[model samples]
Target: MTRALSHGDPLEGLPSRARIAELILSSRPPLDTYVGWQHYRTHCGLLVPAPTISPRQWSMLPESRQYDYDLYRELTNANLPLQDTPMHDKVGKLIRRRLSSNTRKKDDPTRAGVMISGWGNYGKTASVCSAGAVFEEQWLALHRCLNPAALPGARDLHAPVVYVSTPVTATPKSLCASILGFFRAPTRKSATLPELVRLVADSLHDHGVKALILDDISRLRMHRADDQDVLDLMRAFMSLDVTLILTGVNIPGIGLLREAMWNKTTRQWELPPLESTRIHGLEITQTEHRFDLIEIDRFRYVTPKQIGVFVDHLTGIEQHLRLLNAKVGMLTGGTMPEYLMRRTGGVIGLLGRLLEDGAHEAIGGKELIDESLLDEIVLRRDGPEQAPDEPVIPTDPPSAAKPPQQTKSTRPRNTTFDDHGPASATGR
Candidate 1:
């Protein structure tokens, strides 16, 4: 029942809950229970209806009917499959780095560039957006610094960080509008590519942003761009001279990225799933059985003793759960546990769902994600219906071998519903 956006409107005229309340609570009722009914009135006096059966009957309604109705409201609101995952905290460090670096030395002003490199549903947008309050605060601060005379409309350019996660129906114009729109800055009437490029560069120059993050760029380009166009874009950016961070899975044959940076070298960083050490560090205990030890070599700081302790704790927990599964069952339903384990191996990426499912099980005795639960944690990623699958094992490939970059982040909330990716509910 998850509602699809209808002609750009997610709500399809099913009387909103607010309206339902408006129809019901019209006037003062009987003197006896009136105060109590008024106090409990929902929808903020918005919906109205003459209860076919008394309000008492509504309360005494069968549990099955109440559950079904609860689902109806949820699906109509466009809720995702898995909704419990904490927004990943990836953007904080990057944003801090850019903010601090921007003012330390004032060179010619430029736009901030940052890229959150990873697979889909891996917190690319949530990285910066979860703490949107902070971004708003930073924007206000920078807005105060802009001197209008020296730079006309520079005040609007100060809101530097914006989250752009729209993957479907993305065009250059709309994308430009979305970014400029973030600052309440103006764009040319046409919002043409050249015009947008000019305005973005100038605005960036006036305000002095250090980085610009264009996450999920893998999906947006104007289909099959040639190297020459890429070169042109590179040259344009060079004039503005802001650090540009573009993220996406590696694409073959398309040299737009390589061509753009032909004369310049851009730093490339790979963000894989959370390593096994971090997972082990959670310190969750297992009821019974032992866990396995995954070697650690990718990260540099942790010591061997710390690693061993973490492994012991983590494996103990995993083994305990596995044994429970042997007696009970594994987390399976929407996206199979085997599939998630295989693709997302060792990545604490699924930590959110794992915790959520565990919590649900604690309360309801559900073995795995069910239809209703799956809708709770899904983080929707868009693009190709299917792509070549990645290797099942987490082992590294040969130095010369190239592992195809595909989605390594999809997991199910429960077995009850289909996946639609995670979209926000109500608000944050």
Candidate 2:
């Protein structure tokens, strides 16, 4: 008799990739969904669902062997072995190889080095932290989350990974002092950086820490020369056997960790916009059959109405996938993908706004999004508000696109917040 498995069963050669899939056939989630899921995982790491028997007794199916993402394994458990799901079993190995390459580097003591750099909001901090967390779980699962014995450590820290958040005001002295503060609380008198670093290197050497993440490097700005407090601190971490992951909003000054630490062989990855279409396929594809879809007469891109509908009917996995798609599109486009993609100056801080004023005007007894109604929306948004609920005679010619209720501004006067929250500066 074929035993049906509940959770990711090791005995089942392949795990059902998606939680809810086609009734007749069982298989991996579609490729589009996989791509979108990868993007989200790039940001949230283990938070992304991986096919794994969760660390729970009820779901446990021990006799089976399954494959799963290493990051997912690190997140849930390190022991009492379980298996990875099918899709995971396939991609998990590749992901692990990449993770290992970044961590282990090359064995040649001085030859291989590391530098993680990318444009702002490229998901660097999140990625490195995820990597660090995985490495920790892999190496330190036997120990408490944070061992107390290391608190006064000149000793007792045999760990291979170190996760540290470099502060905005970090200087050569402050940076060294920060590491020392972690090892031994700083004195009433601020210990000089040389004093701090000597101890830090000694402590790291004593403990055998292997990898370090210096995140948010843009925050640290101490422009001093080599051998002076500056060069030594930047160069110090590389001396240890630890793999170093340097994260910054943009390329750090002089690129590479520091002039001294720069070596030829570091791997780099730049994160880009996630694919919303893929996400759409994952969450909303199943329901496409429910909709009436004889090939359309004209070309029409997605609309908010369609988005709203997709948001309304989908749930659980479907909903999550759609939201991720929406985010990916927004992240890739500057709000007005409707106006065409040409206007994205690429700086979100300087990106334009999306006003519902046009949406409001267009809502009045309107069929298609006509130019006049759209123009009126633009006018109304740019122009001052008419007396509360007073009929606004739109400057543009009449159109079928707007409903009468829309021109009246049902929105309460002086309203500052949206149904979601205080209005986004761009939304306004």
Candidate 3:
């Protein structure tokens, strides 16, 4: 055998872009599965598998359709990593600090609690949940490796962090009830506020609850006649030496207790996407420290590279590239960004919705996701009455032009000059 000059290992170093592309197309997970459109529709509260289809029919649909339907069924499924913006990083740090402090020997008596307030879809709740999930995962992993006897009573049963959503217009009683329910602590249906408070406090301590996350705090109103009851309940929880995290819309009620616990001069931790001026009339003390999410630059549209990164993260790098080459094409690198930003005002939720709807329309027609599909989706979402002035790009397949979901009636007959319109209908 001729001594084979060893061809240097072809597989060495990072795989070539073409090789990766081949792997993506060959992967079992289809490109459509990871494209996040269905999740957007579900988030917007649109039903998936539509009401017309039974579960059997849904299951019988092609794999691609099933995948989209599954996404629609699970709207909150979009759990993208916190964007690496300054504000998100700051929020992450604050969350880590709060979580770590739960295990500290001496509580920071000088500091009251953390309040994370931000505009809608600014990731306040997601950040908190991510932190809690991380802590829980790490704690559980460590617990699994250690001996059961090494930990004291109930370590296996109770988590280090407890998350609770504040009930809308939450009175002291309702708030306490939600907390008690979280702990599964027993209480009479008619238990008074004081009794409930005492029971909850004891339960929290006994269960070794280290941190309490009260989310959507804006829902809890302080306008009740007996606001002191709410104050007292909070004081009781604070006395437990557990970390307190209150997060919600940047509303006055979010930090009512934190303000009372620490003086106005004391710094508070706030969520980002805030204006330079005072936010929601909450004073920023001289010492006020805030973790803010930077609003996506409104003037500059989201670039295709940024979107590709997002999709790659959500789905996979290989899948993303495949979509770009196969279905997304030049649109991924074109004026689609400006068009989308113009329609959505760069709102994250709207952007997600547009992508989601566009993805489905593209898949249905077995074609690329293009500007025409995006414009149609936007028009349908924003207002079906108004049509974009762009030259129609023929989104729907030639053989299957989709009928408008709803048609506009001819000018409501201008009721004042109606030939037989308003008066005849009302028998006036």
Best by lDDT: 3
Task: List residue ranges in candidate 1 displaced over 4 A.
Answer: 1-95, 108-113, 128-158, 165-175, 181-193, 202-211, 220-223, 226-243, 250-344, 354-428
Model 3, 63-121: lDDT tens digits are 75555443432221232223444345566677677667655647454224567765565
Residue 47 error, candidate 1, Å: 26
Candidate 2 per-residue C-alpha lDDT over 148-238 given as tens digits, one digit per residue, 9 for 90 to 100: 3354634364545554556556567666655544444444456665676677777666655555556565554445342234434555466
1 or 3, which is superior by lDDT?
3
Ranking by TM-score: 3, 1, 2
lDDT of 1 by residue, 225-265 (tens): 43234424533453354455454533211222221211112
RMSD of each: 24.1, 24.8, 18.4
Instruction: Compute each candidate's TM-score over C-alphas.
Output: 0.40, 0.38, 0.55
- Residue 400 of model 2, lDDT score: 78
Question: What overall lDDT goes with each candidate model?
Answer: 0.39, 0.38, 0.49
lDDT against true structure, model 2: 0.38
Candidate 2 deviant stretches above 4 angstroms: 1-111, 141-159, 182-190, 220-223, 226-228, 252-318, 321-428
lDDT score, candidate 3, position 321: 19
